[model samples]
Target chain A: MNELEKRLLDGFQRGFPLTERPFAEIARQLNAEEDQVIGALEGLSESGIISRVGAAFAPGGIGASTLAALAAPPERLEEIAELVNGFEEVNHNYEREHRLNLWFVITAPDRDGVDRVIAEISRRSGLEVLDLPMLESYRLNLGFDLQWS
Target chain B: MNGIPAIDHMDRQIVLATQEGLPLTARPYHAVAKRVGLEPQEVIVRMRRLLDQGVIRRIGVIPNHYALGYLGNGMAVWDVADESVLEMGRMIGDLDYVSHCYLRPRFPPEWPYNLFAMVHGHDRGQVLERVDKINAVMDEDARAHDVLFSTRILKKTGLRLPT
Candidate 1:
């Protein structure tokens, strides 16, 4: 990719626009047209450089949320992943390199739902879970600017 | 200055498109377009605007923290002499394994943890060892350092673009 493409990719990682005709608005600033902006983002996604272009909600702003993980055997990794992914509340899941190999985040309409989902995962996957709720939020902003970097 | 920044529906669509389908190939834009129903060029331009406005930060892959084998994830909070907090923040943020570092508004009697920095390692022992390394480099008068190892993670996603 060219330098311009790199810059574009870097920019999108922070956040996406939350307005009508957001692409056109972005185009107005980037010195490019709406079509060009849209195309570039699509290319970025195809390239594996940027994961996705969407809104990342502030924790607890949307609903109840919790970070949970499981200690699963290698043989059952696939099955466990499927079970966790089945829940709509399960947004992100990763196989971290730890005794807690299966890590995921679940958000629901309320605290009760969050608890119920965890219980379901335990029953179906047959793995013990470690649920970590946010005790204190210190500095929660994850926005990063690439042009500055 | 008055408003955080106002956005529109198209802008929201772009964010949704990217989040839903992150390209994993050489031509990410083309890949995203197929999913979002837009051309590669359009995606590129919109991203640039988001960057300029400081809405989007950088676009990069977040390596699986565990995949890198730095499994010991802990939030180390410190009560430093207010005078040296800024200097110390820079020092801590510079750590190779410290993915996030910052100072937040302090609420006394209820919240005392300040000067938060996230460090990860392969195990508790490794994480603790690094914490020791951090402590060793500290200047005098920095007190009450504590590590809150994340017992679990609830949600880890990018910022929600105003929609």
Candidate 2:
């Protein structure tokens, strides 16, 4: 990463300006041109370095969500995973290494919607779903320093 | 769990407008405010208030770990004693490698892990090393632990409110 890229990653993780011409504000702070700053951000997003430039809502603050797991038979894991991923509510689905290998996050506008999705997944996959909603959050922030090696 | 405070219609509109992302423009907030039919100044003020109220965690770039070359990410779950779990969780969460740490409910018979800390590293070995360090920190309080490395991402999307 070059100096400009490093600065972009470090400075913009949080506290991005909330104003008209926000990119211009960033450019002023970094002593770079407005277009350069915008171009760099565009490049970063295009390269998938940053998912998006937006707000991250607190869990359960804006909508209902739950972490669910399923113990799919190894032979049928792929098929069952595809079935589980078919739900729009299932935003994050991952294949982990465990008996309860197929873990996913179901988010909805309300608690009832979350439960409905879980039930549908259970019925469709023919597997028992272990719904583990977050009881307490010690730390939920995902921003971190990008250590350039 | 605390009751969720009801958000007003305007707040809902603001969230809906920015749920995907702020527009990439010289005047992004103005663009969003325009779409939501609110003044740019009002949009900024509302966003600031939302941040203060913990409704909006942060307003910034959300980095993709996998794209940043942190390929090995493990959801390390631990069977820590309930009495010391919170303190242990705080300690684990303070580690730089641990991004998200939460106390989630554990199911009996099949699932016993209650504490979860997401560990990220450049490779599988690095992730395991971090897990070992976490285990060492927990010491005897951690009865058992397991690291479930994600093999594939079936679906990944940001949280979005129903429109």
Candidate 3:
């Protein structure tokens, strides 16, 4: 990516604007036309530079989100991934290289519901649910420049 | 995502309009556009600019922590050996269980843990066990680390532009 693309990513991640003509405003700032700005973003999303274009909320603020994992064998990895991602409560899931194996975050309507969901998963998958809830938050910021030097 | 340009008031309106959650209905962008008093395409155009510039990282659902029953959540830091951290970090992050994992600059005197990952479990025991599993994958004499769990959630918002 060129310097301009890198700069745009940095600005988006750092401080996103909220406005009616937000793109037009951004175009004015970047000295680009609104159409150009829109087109570039479409291209960016198409190029897999970003996953999506929307809001990211804190799970607990509205409901509850937990970090849950299962020790799925190699044979059942795909099956497990499908099962875990099936639930509406399950938002993000990934494969980590740990003994625990499959790792996923479950978001629910309430904190108590997390336990029920885990129990249901445990029953279906027959995998022990190791639940780790957040006890304290020292530094919770996850914003970083995509092209930080 | 890369980076977006520093935004202005107009951009702030667009962001605020879509901040809470995008309507799941058809033409979700239309509602956002109407609220902002701009054409749907114009709103789309502006959203594109923000995405192009990396103004918005992603538009997705953020799990509710309290509702999830993951009462225990914390930033678990590890004192990983330099050689293994790069691989270890990726491995840990790859886990479907771990929501986030990354290497952060650690201060010697103040912050001892350079590698940080957010671990969420139903309880402290489960969280510790998960940490233990991650630790077992590391070198025997790897640097020590600690977990800074959140006792109370002060504030939780994705990204806020200067209004």
Candidate 4:
């Protein structure tokens, strides 16, 4: 990656300007052209180095969100994971090294919507679902420093 | 969310229209306004309000940890007692290596962890060392803990509000 790309990925994790011409604003700060800034961001997104460049809502703020887990049998893990992924409500699902290996995040318009998805998943997979909703947060949005050589 | 100010229907539309991402164009908000059938200036104004209200955390480039060479993703869950959990969580969250930390409910005997700290590293050893540092801070206060390394990402998507 070039200096422009590296600086963009490292520096612009948060506090991106909100304006009609946000790319232009970024260019002003980084000493680059507005077009260069746009091009760099487009390239980063296409290369999978950056996911999105938009709003990140607080969990349970707009609607509701919860972290849930279920211990799927080794042989059924893939099948269960696929099943969980089928739900639009399941935004993130991961297989981790634990008995309760299949973990996922569920978001809904309301708390009941979140619970419905969990109940449906448990019923479909025939496994106990652990609903571990966040109680308190101890961290704020501290940006990341990406020093990839 | 008790203290969070409520947004109206139009604001919700703006969020739905741009939640995936802002356009890569120079006039990104203008494009969002077009999608949501609002004026360009209105989109910018509402988004600003959302940011101030904490309804929207931030608008920015989200780095893909995997692509950036962060191969090991460890979910370090620690069982800290209720009394000290707040201070303990703050200590762990203060770690430079900890990307984010939260206090969640424990399911007891089966799942005896209330504090979750995400530590990303180039490899398992590096991730483990970071987790060890957090453990050191908790000292004897930590009753039990375990680091669950993510083996696979089944799915990942931007947060989609139920429309």
Candidate 5:
């Protein structure tokens, strides 16, 4: 990555300008033109170094969400993952290295929605769904501290 | 997201529009406003409200952890005493390498863990070391703990706005 790109990735994780022209504001900080900053950001985004330039919501602050898991046999892993992801509510699903391997997150407009999805998945998969809802959060995402070295 | 005040139709539009992310442009909000069929000022106001309300934690660049070389990702789960979960969670969260720490429900007789901390490192060895530090912190108060490394990221489509 180029120097400007490094700074863009490193420095702009948080506190992105909320002004009328945010790119221009970023440009001033990085000593680049507005279009150049925008172009660099676009390149970073396309390259998949950055996911997006937007808001990170507070989990369960708007809609109810729960971190859920299911243990799928090796043969049924893909099928079960598909089944879980089939719901619009299942946002993140991961194959963790454990017996209870299929970990996922479900978000819905309300507690009932979240519970219904979990119950449905549990019923369909025939595997026990672990509904591990957050009791308390110990950390706030201030943005990852990307190490350049 | 918890404690969401009733969002109007327009605010919901703005959330859905930006949920994927904002447009990469000189006037990204303007672009979002136009697409969502609202004026730029209104979009800005709504977004500001969302941020202030904690519905939107922060408005900024979201980086991919894997792309950023955080290869060692593990969800370390500890079966700790219920009374001390908050204290233990705070202790774990204070660690630099631990990205997230939370007290989650445990499914006993099968899964027995309450405290979950997401530890990130450039590789597994580093992650293990960090997990070891967590073990050291709790000592015997942690009845048992296990680090479930992510073998594969099957899906990571982040948070979805409830439709």
Candidate 6:
């Protein structure tokens, strides 16, 4: 990574200016041209380094969300996973190595919606659903320092 | 300003406008304000207030760890004692490798893990090393634990509010 890209990744994790010209503000801070800053950010996003430049809503604030899991038979794991992922409410689904392996996050517009999705997944997969909703968030920040090694 | 406070219509509009992502342009907020039919300054003020009120956790770049070569992401679940879970959670959350640490409910007889800590690394070995370190820190308080490595991303997207 070039110096400009490094700086952009390192610096813009937080405190992105809320202004008419945010790229310009970033440019001023980085001592680079406005277009160059925009270009670098575009490249980063294109390269999939950054998912998006936006607001991360507090969990369970605007919508109801819960971490749910299911133990799918190894032979049918892929089928069940695809079934669970079929729901639009299921945003993140993963296959883990455990008895209760098929874990996913169900995000819906409301508490009732979350319940509905869970019930649907359980019915479709014919497996017990373990709805482990977060009681308290000790830390939720995911940003980390980009080590240039 | 510290808890999940109620949001007004305008606040809802702002969230709906920027939930997917902020526009990648020189004037991103201006684009958002235009979409939400609010002035640029007003949008900024509302966003600041939202941040303070804990509605919006942050306004910044959200990176994809997998794409960044931190391929081995483990969701380490621990079966810690109820009394020590909170304290241990705080300590685990303080670790640089641990990105997300939360107190979640546990289903007994089948699922005994209550605490969830997400650790990431470039490979499975690195992730396991971090998990070992976390286990060392927890000591005997963590009765049992398991690492759940995500094999596939069935679906991944930001939470969407009812518009």
DockQ top scorer: 4
lDDT, candidate 1, A1-149, per-residue tens: 66556656556544444334556656676788777777776665566555455433444533467767677898887878777877777876766655567767777746788899999998887777766655334333454323222
Better of 3 and 5 by DockQ: 5
Give a tens-digit lDDT track for model 6, residues B134-157.
Answer: 899889999999998988776777
Ranking the candidates on DockQ from highest down gives 4, 5, 2, 6, 1, 3
What are the per-residue Cα lDDT tens digits for candidate 3 across B1-163? 0112456667778776776555433356778878988888887777666655545444432334444466566567787766677777777776545666766454454345556687777777878888888888775635796766554432233332222
Off by over 4 Å in 4: none
Clashing residue pairs in candidate 2 (N, C-alpha, C atoms within 3 angstroms): A21-B26, A21-B27
| TM-score head-to-head 1 vs 4, winner | 4
For model 6, the superposed segments whose C-alpha errors exceed 4 Å read A140-142
Error of 4 at A101 (Å): 0.8
Q: What is the C-alpha lDDT profile of model 5 across A43-109, one tens digit per residue?
A: 9889988888888888877678899988899999999989998998888888999999999999888
- Give one digit per residue, the lDDT tens place, for model 4 in A1-149: 88899888777888889776888888999999999999998998999988988878877667778999999999999899999999998889999999999999999887999999999999999999999988887877556666565
DockQ of each candidate relative to the true complex: 0.09, 0.73, 0.05, 0.79, 0.74, 0.68
lDDT of each: 0.61, 0.86, 0.60, 0.87, 0.86, 0.84
Which lDDT tens digits does candidate 2 get at residues B1-163? 3554656789889988998788788889989889999999999999998888788878888888999899999999999899999899889888888888989998997899899999999999999999998888789999989999999888888765654
Give lDDT: candidate 6, residue B109: 83
Cα-based lDDT at residue A144, candidate 1: 34
- Global Cα lDDT for candidate 3: 0.60
lDDT of 4 by residue, B104-153 (tens): 99997789999999898888999999888878878988999999999899
Q: Which ten residues in a row have the lowest lDDT in candidate 2 chain A?
A: A137-146
TM-score for candidate 6, residues paired by index: 0.94
> In model 1, which regions exceed 4 Å deviation?
A12-19, A145-149, B1-163
TM-score of chain B of each: 0.77, 0.94, 0.78, 0.95, 0.92, 0.95
List residue ranges in candidate 5 displaced over 4 A. B1-6
Number of clashes recorded per candidate: 72, 2, 76, 0, 6, 0
